[model samples]
Target: MPSYALLRRRRSGSRATADHATADRTADHTAGAGPRRRLRGLAYLALGLPVGLLALVVLGALTAPVLMACARPADISSWADAARRAALLTFGILLTVGVAPLAAAPLAALERHRLRVLASAPTEPTAPEPRPHAVRFRARYTTARAWREVAAGYLVAVAGPGLVLLAATWAVLCPIWLAAPLVVARSSGGPVALGIGHARSVPDALPYCAAGLAAGVLGIVVLITLVRAQAALSRTLVEPRPDPLATRLVEVTRSRSRLADGFAAERRRIERDLHDGAQQQLLGLTLQLGLARMDLPADSAAGQAVARAHDQAKTLMADLRELIRGIHPQVLTDRGLGAALYELAEFCPLPVAADIDLPHRPPQAVETAAYFAAAEALANALRHSAADNIRLTARVRHDRLTVDVEDDGRGGARLADGTGLTGLADRVAVVDGTIRVSSPPGGPTLVRVTIPCPPHPQEDDR
Candidate 1:
């Protein structure tokens, strides 16, 4: 086993163990926390709005009965007595009707805040998982907050009695004022049968019930409207921070694309330089020697010199060939990625395998990128992985051309500041492709390349 392979295997084992250990620690913490969390909730409830509202309602109900009992007339035993109490009864009813409106005003504001608080709570949970639609307000109110909101509603109910009393008092006073003039006139003897004794006035039943009901309905409607408005306001205020992540993603993709184009362009320029400069010069020199051979005698000193030139030209040709191969191997263009990769595997010192499935011929750019990435990956495997074997697989599916370059060697491969794979990655990006390198510092190292399929003609139009 090579050193890199052994190191990779060790790293893989450690990662698995660490993951399990962390999970166990998390579980233990959660288990211990459950009971205490519940107790804190119960404590908040005992002192909170629910308790306050219960006490308020209890006090109101207890006082209401006693007050009503004491206020009732004891001498009213006949219809005539009932008529006396009628005034007080009318007063109470009218007061109740008048007060409902005033109570509704603040009640509406309270309802608005209640809904707003509810919506805000759910939104505050740290980063809920993303969904297709906008996040819904699903705030869970703590017992304390719920109680407080409900208790505040008591203020709305409190003003009810006062409103009714005001209306009833006004009703009584109006009748008395009208009767005062009549009573004075009667005292002056407008009619012998006329008297200034108290007369019961019939209270208007229609106005009392209609006013109270209308006030209640209006209050409820306004409350709902305000609550909805507040919810809208809260959403605007506390929305997710404008996610610049998508913009960053686009920028990164473009940057990668530019890097890819630059890398590819550089390789092409280098290849051209090698072919036009050194390779051309070597070919010319060989041709010149061939022509020189014709003028020299077989056994002559000139002939021997010609022979040496011929041999030198052949050696230089070989050197030129090697240099061209280094730039972009001939096999790559001649036979496409599959054959070129096989040639790469044969040259590797360690064991290697090729699993290639080409559904269709890819575009020239795609093939070129794949070729370079595969070659560079193989070189890295041979030099660093020290692995027993490597796997090279290529396939085209779902409008994407994918290639997987794997080595069973010591993992932990990073695109360092200066590395052949880094250059290869840049090249791959030119065709809107991505490269992911997963090499834990252990046995298996994998490099996956994915290039988006070129758009169809119809898609381009759309």
Candidate 2:
């Protein structure tokens, strides 16, 4: 039965040890394992050495008097009794005064090291299991979480020493030969056994020693167990989270589909408006003017009426052409983005300079978006920003086309309600281009846009 009990305790202890080892391995995996952790441990060891030495020296200094009194034959008949009492008193004082601050140093160092390890951990981990909780908790709860973790390290501090003390006390008591001094002195009942010399007087001292050893061991075990528990909790709580690749891919596909639909809808609206409204009006007006010109020779008053009708027809033709150009100009469709931008610069009321540098033509979608953004910027400069001179520059570089409209005008552009700038912003966004308007209230408004262009045409590149 005793053998069985011993075997069971060993097994339980082994499992606990294994669990702790596994936890540490997991934390190491979560936090970049390898020479780095070992290096950090070495560094902490180096730092902790001086501190440990200082503690030992200071404790020795404080304990010198007690050591002397225990060994002194003149002061006390029994050194064991004096030493044991002093040890109890000293341990109590140290617990009350010194243990807290002394333990804080290692706890703080460990925490700082752990945090650094966590920070250096891979943000995108490939492992299926979540990272050690300590790393995750720190990332989420930040400093507050780290503080709680540090506070929980005390359990380890208590357990290690407690176990050592238990082992030492067991050695001191169980040996029959070692206990002979007390047994012989008690049997003799001499002056040594009575009052001052009680190696013999305290017959039950052996049991008392065993009980004290057990208590000390239990306390230390509890402390270490508590610390390990806290460490496990931190690992389960703190690590970074990963998103499945499938979810991300699906979101991207949906966005592209929506953009394609928006592009097609915008193009159809422009085409229908031009064909139904502008093209038909221009065709009808041209026919009416031709009939009026043919009727001019019949009568003088009738000729004047015919000429007036022709003038009205000519005005309608001009409006139709402007409307058609606004929808999608023939020059842009035929010659490409460069020719369209040049025309825009020429029409601007301000003294505008054009710098068109394109190695090759971009896609139709890119060209259309760039042209309109430039046009809107120039219009804003002419109307709102009271500018005298403006510079228009366009370039296609490294598979990207960029348009910049800069003016030395009163500069206050904002994304307010019903502002044309807002619509211009939306138009740029539709093409996956971004517009940056740096219009500070006094003067000089600049609008720059960049759009991702498809592969350049080889002929245009030449």
Candidate 3:
């Protein structure tokens, strides 16, 4: 082992080295970040120029009729001329309304891309595509999103050129100002003309250099600020404003999904604990009781008591197994959904005609929701419908899981009648699924549930 003094010296040297490394890294980052930000701002200004010009062209086209109408000279008082102008203006108005959305859409998309690349700002998701049968022109013209795009285009046309001009002025002046000392030194021995006074020597140019430094710093600050402002305006006009109702609905749906997942996880945990812990202990106890009965005399009272205890232990063991299966079945975990449904049918008293055709297993949450919904429906049918024969059909169709439980019996099953179906409905809703019951009095009852789920990749691999 090293001496205490030597260890202390080594530790101090290591700490000092670490501190130096951290300072170097911080300095390097600071050096890199300033130039990166300035480059981004400059690029944004340069790109905005062309976009602004294009927007101006589009706006001018849209306003041509109004401009023409306003510029109609106070000469030529002919009725035919006025009528021709009126007809032209009316046609122009119709054309403007038609062309506004077409021009605004591509321009808005380009602006969004520019903001994303240069300003690191992401806009809201675009609206979904219209249906094939939808009236494309009318649908495009009527939407608030389309109008917002038009307004954004107008804003860009008005503000973009002004920002570019300001940036250009700063870009030109700041460099010249910063090079004041260099300019003075490079000039002939005669006094160099500075901004307002003459610089006879390098020493005389010091004040101008200081002023240049200040101006350069100020210019950078102004450029960054204006870039940020432009990005904010673009985002405000291009992105859709969040609707309070829609936001709340999304939150509620997410919360419900989380709760459903938690419930499924908890069920699995309970099943695991019972299967591994309590069930094992119960099995061992049953074996012990059986051994005790065998070792005792058949005629003795002790042997009879042992026999009765052994029988009770076996019964309890079976009940516990059933309880574990009910919580979350081992078969469901090991053999996927189709096997689990068949196992469920095996336990039911009524003869269940199962027609299960699944190409692959769905997500765990969806599978759990579907299994419980089906189980509840079948239970309700067996208890209330007095059904002698039942049909359970489960299949994956169009990226959705559909399960139908139909029974032939005297049926008056109504969800509003305060049955278990209400709880089932709530359960299905947690996973964004739906349950429907069609039961007429004195007839066959059909309980159908539909849950949206894509096939699992692991199952696909299998």
Candidate 4:
């Protein structure tokens, strides 16, 4: 080992070297910052100009007639002219009102992408606003947010070209001005014209070069400021507005999911208790009764009583097993939804044609919901459909579980008419699933159930 003083000297050298390296890196970063920001500002201007021009063209085309109709001649002496102007105004208003919302959506999407890529802004694709009675056109098109987007689109169209023009003018002029001295030196002996005078040599162009350098620096500052302002405006207009109702709906959905999970866990607990505790006890009692009957005399009353008790005990045990299955099937827990469904088909009184193709099992709650919905639909078909054949098809596609049940029964099934479908609807709704009934009052009832669930990965490996 070296002496302590020597070691101290070596450590000090290392620290000094590290500090010098850090300082160099920082200086390099500082030197490059202006060019990087200038490039970013240029990119923003280039992108915004084309998008703004496109928006202007489209919006202008859509609203031109409306603007023209508003510019009616002061002299409306003829009734026909008045009527024509009114009709034109009405048509233009209707057209703009109808098409503006659709156009705004795509424009807003482009703006959002530009902001996210160029400004490094945190942004997300906006989901469509939810509304009740969405099937009606009025409900979908008459929202305030839709009009707000249209206004934003117009603003972007108008402002984009203006800002780009200013930025581009400064960008071109600054470079040309800064290179004045070089231009003067390269020119022929004849004088090159400056803004107010002529320069015959590089020395005479010094003032122009100084002015250009100053202007270029100032231009960079202005460009950065304008780019930031544009980004802020785009974000304000294009970003999704926070809706309290939507937020609350999301919270409610999460709470419902949690509750469903808790309920599923509780159901497993109950099924376990019955299977391991009560059902096992009942099985033991059943065996004891069978043994007691064997010991008694065949002709005596005690023997007959013991035999009857044994038969009743066996019946009760089977019923208890069925109850346990109804609560939560062991096959579902062990094998999967596919196996459980096929087993269910085996027990159905009617002939069931089952086609179940699942790559993997879904979540426990989803499986439970789907199984019960299928069971209910099958039961309804059997009791009321009055048809012979029933078909059941289940598959997992695009992260959704779709189960369809169809019957060739005398069909008059209706959800609101209280055919047990309302309960199924409610149950499916708890898991953010949907149930559709298509029984057109004559025959052939079809109940389609769709539940959103991603497949369980571990189950797929098995």
Candidate 5:
């Protein structure tokens, strides 16, 4: 039994040792794979270096002749020669500047393809707007994007290959040269050296060979880093920058609109809670007063008190209902903007003529903005305007809801005025809307608000 147990212990120890060896091999493989893959990617750029250089050469060839022709003597011997000279200068200028876009089409396309496919960049070149071919050609020449590519191409073509060649030579050739001396000494049993001095034996050659190998490995790493840097620069120079102010403005507007919607939702929630909870309690009180009155004599003080209590509860309940409506109307949610506006007009003390025409409900933010704007305008009219008649009109056209509130009153409503028009303007703007108040001094004041909605929603590129 003791011998058997000893054998079992040995087997377990051997298995654990084998597992550890396997893990060590895996770790080494993982570490080396990263550098190997990086080097492989670097090779792709090295191969591309020649193509870039060749493109630069082609561009130079196309542009150089034109330059030379332009520089040729303008004061020719004959009128015919002068005409020819003028034509040549024009051709050269046209080829370099005017037709440069056309000349660069193939190179730009190739660059875009390389970026998208090989380098895995979303560097898709914007297609020229479709028009007459001549028009398109002219546009391409003028386009900054196309011109930038030409500039980048010229830079890469001239310098890219030269850099790649130097890196490749350092990374590949030096190591081979260093190792050759050692290999020769080992094979032939003779002296060899990689030029620092003659190595008489393999031991003499070892240091030089090892130095070369280390340098080659380092060079490979450097080459990969350079390739990566070049790609980054290329991408930076090519991509167009979005307008900072415009993008931020859009983002801010959207954010504000979101806040406005949230505020409206919260208001609705509070309105519902009050309507459901408090209103029911008030109704129950009114009912209890009625029940208490029925059980008592009609002329009794308690009966009279009960009657007054019932009336007061009913009046209070009505006031609370109106308050809830002001907060966030249930009519607005159930019957849409038209019904809501109509209900608002009915409550106003002044004669309000409402003309609300809409096919569908707009976005919540837009609807809320429009509703509050109309309400504010009416309030302003009641406070300031001496007019008895107010006309409120809402119409939806061209994917926008326009609300107009006109009051005949002594008018001088400015954004400078602290009469809440400025706040209304800001609220309207949150949903990418506009508010225009034509309230000149001494006459009819009209507040018109236009809010965007539907078919064409606001873009959130920011």
Candidate 6:
């Protein structure tokens, strides 16, 4: 260990060293960075055209071999010929639509850095949300950015670069040829031929050099034009388009339909389980308890208990049966919506008259939607509408089922009053159905529901 003073001295020396290094870095950054940045900018401009040209070259190389094979069908076996024809057609479409877009993705991702450093344009990117594989794949081709990028690729990677390459070659070579007279003037005793024509003397070099100078100038102008054009094209094409609300509405509608289908299937499953499994077990238990009661003395406490247990089991079984029917009724599946509506009307608190006429049963989905809508309507009328009499009328025609529920009840029934009308409406909408409630402040309420019914499965099979 050193003395405290020595340690302090060592620490000061280290601090000085670090400070000097930091200052040097700052100086370098302030002075040297500008030219470094300028050269980098120039380098970017210089190589941008070539980069685009190279992309075109790569696209050609990648696609050419397959394309050549596709061109001649007779050279390959018949199956292979057919397969390659299909593949070639697919490739042609991919190329026309989005092969360029796929190619541009990498460049677009990195181009921001190049633009900020060289072109002086910068844009922030939005964060991407995770999506299912199918959705992501669809977006790759369908997005406007991808399509615009496709357009940009054709101009930047193919057309712009091609012109730039040709002009660049002439620009570089012609200027050197402008100095050709010096060498030619001494080398040959006779006239030497150049592009413009023969040069007999040193004075003859004027036209040659002037022509070369003009060509070089033109080439420079073209290259500059191409660079600016490419940058602008990229900016325009790589941005996304604004989506409309109608599109979102369609998606929401599809999602609701899927959910409704899933819910209906689940209800059916629950009904099947309760009816076939639990309810049967309870019924067996009830029968066994009745037999036990018969074997015991009537006045005994044990006998009384057994009798009571049997009655309770029977009641539980009956309730389970009702619950299962409520979930998904066997009567609806067997006898159709018309019969189901009649059965529901029979159970209503208020007297109901039903007029249900149909040539044949509709599709299961349509029947289910109509049955539930009618059930909800009847319930709503009895509980809130204070209805004494209800009329349930249904008719199937023109590939549709229309049901009308009319009640002579208290004047007002609004969906806003939380009468479950909106829920029923949504259920109807899932099957491409419509519901209308016409209820004014006075007395009668008419709820009309219409559902599309596709051709019956038997009709479809025929």
* Off by more than 4 A, model 1: 1-245, 248-252, 269-281, 290-312, 329-335, 342-352, 387-390, 407-419, 422-446, 454-462
Candidate 2: TM-score? 0.43
Superposed by TM-score, candidate 3 places the C-alpha of residue 165 at a distance from the truth, in angstroms, of 5.8
Query: What digit string (tens of lDDT, one per residue) describes model 2 on residues 1-462?
Result: 999999999999999999999999999886766566556433432433343344344444544554554564565548787676677667655553344344443454443444344333535434545788776544433544343433434332333243344444444544433444466555755423322224444454555445545655664465445434534543443332334686786687568647855764576478667777777877787787778778678468887777777777788777766666676666776788899999888867788999999877776667777887888888877888778999999987777788999888778877673446787777777667887778788867778889888664634311
Residue lDDT tens for model 1, 84-118: 56755665545533343333333434334333344
- RMSD (Cα, Å) of candidate 4? 8.1
How would you encode candidate 3's per-residue C-alpha lDDT over 249-307 as one tens digit per residue?
Answer: 99989988887787888999999999999999999999999999999997899999999
User: Cα miss at 384, model 1 (Å)?
Assistant: 2.8
Misplaced by over 4 Å in model 4 are 1-38, 60-105, 121-141, 172-219, 281-316, 334-367, 373-424, 431-462
lDDT of 3: 0.83
- Give each model's whole-structure lDDT: 0.61, 0.63, 0.83, 0.84, 0.76, 0.76
Per-residue lDDT of model 6, residues 101-185, tens digit only: 5676665554434455454344566777789989877776887776665565555567545665666677666865688577467
Rank the models by TM-score, top first: 3, 5, 4, 6, 2, 1
Instruction: Encode model 5's per-residue lDDT on 287-310: one tens digit a residue.
Output: 888899899888999889888888
Error of 1 at 136 (Å): 11
Candidate 4 lDDT over 274-376, as tens digits, reads 9999999999999999999899997899999999999999999999998988888888888888998998888899999999999877877788899989999
> Best lDDT goes to which candidate?
4
- TM accuracy, model 1: 0.39
lDDT, model 2: 0.63
Candidate 3 colliding pairs, count? 0
Instruction: Estimate the TM-score of every prediction.
Output: 0.39, 0.43, 0.77, 0.59, 0.63, 0.48
Measure candidate 1: CA RMSD.
26.1
Instruction: Please tell me which model should have the higher TM-score, number 2 or number 6.
Output: 6
Which runs of model 6 end up more than 4 angstroms from their true locations?
1-244, 455-462
- Which structure is stronger by TM-score: 3 or 5? 3
Indicate which candidate wins on TM-score. Answer: 3
